[model samples]
Target: MNEDAQAALGILAQQIRMAGNNPDQPNRVGNANPALSSLRNPVYGTTSLTLAGTNTTSQLSMRGCDGTFTNINSTNTTTTGIDALTCVAGGTNTVPDSIAVSYEADRFNTIPTGGTSSLPTDCLGNKLPVVTATVSTIVAGTASSADVTYTVADNRYYIGTASVANVVTPSLYCKGNGGASVQMPMVENIETLQLRYGTVSTASTATTATVAGYLHATEVLTETSMALLANDAERWAKVATVRICVLVRSENPVAPNAASAQYTDCAGNLVDNPPDLRLRRAYTTTVVLRNRRL
Candidate 1:
């Protein structure tokens, strides 16, 4: 092969390797599989909140995605009755088990209900402070001093934080007709980036979860929506495996005169080549959440 042609092939190989073998950590550390390592830990928070009835107003202060505490109100609502727990004039109380509430990290801050000296205490007796609440709903009970388990919705933690590193986005290089060869800032290249979720119904009975089929990121919409998908806990807890595919193309025309090729892209879309010399390829990998599985 000519020197130019050989060099072009080398470049294509390098790009593919970079896409497949790039460090999954946001800081670009270690040789972890980008497919699985990127999604190592799903962002979520779980805490318990005790309710107080006398005030007809209660708050649960929970940590946000950014590690800040946000207040969640457990105010008595007309629709959801709060008669399960008895609020004594002066006595300790716990939140009822029936009142299940899940919180979203983003929608945490609602109007400030002011500070409460009578805030709910966790199992360890640590007094949790009240901050603010954007969204709060009392699902079942109306007890004055009942214990409520507050789960901050599960979110994609692969995006990384200021201190921690994670890998969720993949990037690639490509050249358009008139534009110089450039790297697409986002999960780039020729076609779609597809993901499939594997969910298990029973953790003990089954060894592997059932594949729920491919889906777009928008399907889950928000962390709250994700919590409600399929079974309440399936979205994150039962997510055993994730399949990722990236369909990409060469930045330069390596296969000139190659007849208009027909191919299937990542999102399972068929495409007819644009009669260009660019070479295209698809890379796929399956990532299992070992922690979730165990």
Candidate 2:
């Protein structure tokens, strides 16, 4: 349980870091990428951790690129084009996680002359294939630039949990090309998972903003509704930090003679009466979203 909880924390932090790509800035007049999704709100989190009871749901969703993509469109694979996004419409037609990326052989020879192209594989490294749609131009009048394009497979990931009574296990969900959300078991025996979003406020004179305080998902949504920002993304843009807390218990109940342990939970409440004798532990960490800042 300890190892699983640690790993889960790391994985959750990574996802939070990649949650937003700053797709929606102050300037939305004409700046929109066709390869990315129309949903600009990067992070959506919810948690119900009170002394009363626990909520077995973590709709904490994040949207961002995962790895370099290979455009499934053969026509978009121009010999001269490089790092082009082929998912022209990201609203309805979502991209999926696909096969390895293939590129032009000996394309290095092409770059020296002018017509250059590539399809490098994202082996261990993942990078968002962000680029413009137009073709590259080497010379003023030369037609050497070819249209480069690639696929944007799966980009959005979220946290979910199994709803079995008394045996809640937090899981991860992701969709490919607008497919059904697949539940991925991240950590077992995670009875309670709580999250808090740190809201930030930037003064007119300050260059960067600091976290004002932490609020639950519902409160954040309410603030977003009151904000005088963009109609769609005002809620998610205000969150600058995320606090993740998960409770992991042993696989089996402990010995009867073993003293029942009392502990404090993720919500800072002391759990006086434990349900069982099984060893239980709480894992927590505060993740800061650098993408939310300048």
Every model: Cα RMSD to truth: 20.6, 14.9
Q: Pick the candidate with the highest lDDT.
A: 2
Tell me the spans in candidate 1 whose CA falls farther than 4 Å from its real position.
1-43, 49-191, 202-234, 258-261, 267-269
Q: For model 2, what is the alpha-carbon lDDT of residue 245? A: 75
Candidate 1, 130-215: lDDT as tens digits: 22312223234431222222212211111111211452322322211111211123222323334444445433334554655433
lDDT of 2 by residue, 152-270 (tens): 22232333457677866554332222122232445566665566778776332226667788865445545543355443134556677887776777777773634565667776777
Q: What is the C-alpha lDDT of each candidate?
A: 0.30, 0.43
Please give each candidate's TM-score.
0.34, 0.53
| Among all candidates shown, the one with the greatest TM-score | 2
Look at candidate 2 and tell me the lDDT of residue 157: 30
